[model samples]
Target: MTMTEARPATPLWRRPWMFPLGLLVAAFLAFSLPPYLGLDPARSRIPAPTGWYYPVLVAHIGFATVAMVTCALQIWPWLRQKHPTVHRRTGRVYVFAGAIPASVAGFAIALAAPFGPVGAVSNVFLAVLWFGCTVQGFRTARARRFGEHRRWMVRSFALCMSIISNRIWGVVWAIVLTPQLDTTFGGSEAALGQAIAGITTWTGWVLPLLVAEWWLGRSRGRRRAPSPA
Candidate 1:
């Protein structure tokens, strides 16, 4: 048989559970690193505007943590396929516990964001896209369109993962590139860090999401077209 014909239609190891498990590990490390390793230095840059800022920051962190944990559970296919009843129950919890609170706190932080209005607007768009994807995922699943549901869930998970990618890129740039930018522009480390963080945050989250949406839409279009006899 030709290579394409010999390949299995569905690989056994290419299960849905694997993706979420990997994402969970990533999310866990992303949140745990700062507290455990003290590698993230950006915590110092969070401007304390008032007593409320601290509380808001704390809330943002707490909500985001919960959201990531619940997001992993919601997406894990072993739990979803083996126990759909439990999956539905957990899905409700995930939507309420993860999506709503995180989106609200994220928006609040975005408004007072120090990176300026561009960063603020980017964050707002991020939250909206995240929330919209989750809602669509739930709606599509309820309508019993599994393909649409999976597509929406993929979009939702991609945005949810921005929480992890933002920190990863920030740390990389701070450790490697910030010194060069500071020397070249005659700017402070703080300014360079903010610039790098803002750019990475947008590119890491928004660009990939747009690309995924385009690719998925094209695949779905191909699937829907009538095959030649």
Candidate 2:
């Protein structure tokens, strides 16, 4: 069969859980992420922010926070299908107000973040992808290439969701590595923090994007698979 003609159906087990789980996670992120954004880096576990840290951090989080909340609202299939206008408008906000400003400011914060060079690099990558994907999505939508727009937007949000994934990875890391923490970091909180930051940095957005790519590839492959006579 030709590509686009041999598409496969999703499994029943996969149908119900994804949406609810996403909403639950989104809710958790909404509730949990804000306090850290405005936090004085010195007062928080985050590396101490340096000169102009407060304003830059605020701008980054301000946009990112809106994106996060709106992203969750837009995730529902019903809203997209039934309220295209809403989707379009919110999507515009998510791109312009949320992802773009947040990413740029995040770049600055990352440079100043004490998580070390690895953390700095990871955050930089996140900032780049976040802005790039959102812009791509916006362009595609404007060009009326909706399928590509959907793909890009999905990719965009996967990056946006990194903040949540980072912490989740941290929790898992802590639990799994508690015994070896001192050995790994030589009893230095700075060393340990850097290690955790580095791991989470990659795992956060990288894993999600990898999964999205895999899913996208599988979908395309199934569509291209030959049909039996």
Candidate 3:
């Protein structure tokens, strides 16, 4: 088959649904496992770090959960196209219900992070990026700039996925690094785990944002250039 003919005949597994399915599964696991593991936000094993507020912590987790789930729905290409109205409505809900609340909670929680000021700084950046992208997305959509809106929203959604990526990195790093740290420094496994989680949380979010920014910028550049006659 010719290249153009072959393109339209690609298999389902090679389509966008694959990534969305993976994200959905990961988000479900992240949300469900915490409860089963007895990792309640209402209580912390570590003393409430500097600025930890119980109400805010609860709100943060709640918002984060909503954001993660809604994000999964938003990013699925089939759902977005097949149900455009539903997508727009849920996108609104995601902005108001998920993105704004989560960003507020994120900023609050960041101040109390156990890793001290550096962690707080990183989290503040995360919250700002999350909120900025989300707000820009809504603004663009309201103006009927669908392409710009979609791109910005995708960046926002990518930022939200860090919630899942953070935990996955934490688990993997803990498994691999715990023994090494324990043997080398005679530190508790718990301490090693905390260290890994702290580092990964920042890197996971920041790296994706950087990548998304590059992608968005390239897209905008292409859109702005005049087409050849």
Each candidate: how many clashes?
0, 2, 0
- Candidates in order, TM-scores: namely 0.74, 0.83, 0.73
Off by over 4 Å in 1: 1-12, 16-20, 23-47, 143-146, 175-177, 182-184, 218-222, 225-229
Cα error, residue 10 of model 3, in Å, equals 12
Give the TM-score ranking, best first: 2, 1, 3
Model 3, range 39-86, lDDT digits (tens) per residue? 464455335554446557667767777787777777655556556677
Q: Give the alpha-carbon lDDT of every model.
A: 0.69, 0.76, 0.72
Error (Å) of candidate 2 at residue 73 is 3.3
lDDT of 1 by residue, 1-229 (tens): 0011223334326675567667665656575646423423346346655556556666666666666666676666556655567767777666677776777777877878777565678888888888888888888777877777778877877787776767676687666766677576476766675667677678768866887789798998999999999
Worst 10 residues of 2 by lDDT: 1-10
Say what the RMSD of model 2 is. Answer: 4.8
lDDT of 2 by residue, 1-229 (tens): 0012223544535458557757766687577666675565554445455768766776777788888877765555555655667877788788788888899999888888877899889989989888898899888888888778778877887888778888789888766666676797677877777777788788888999998888878887998999999
Q: Report the lDDT of model 1 for residue 50.
A: 57
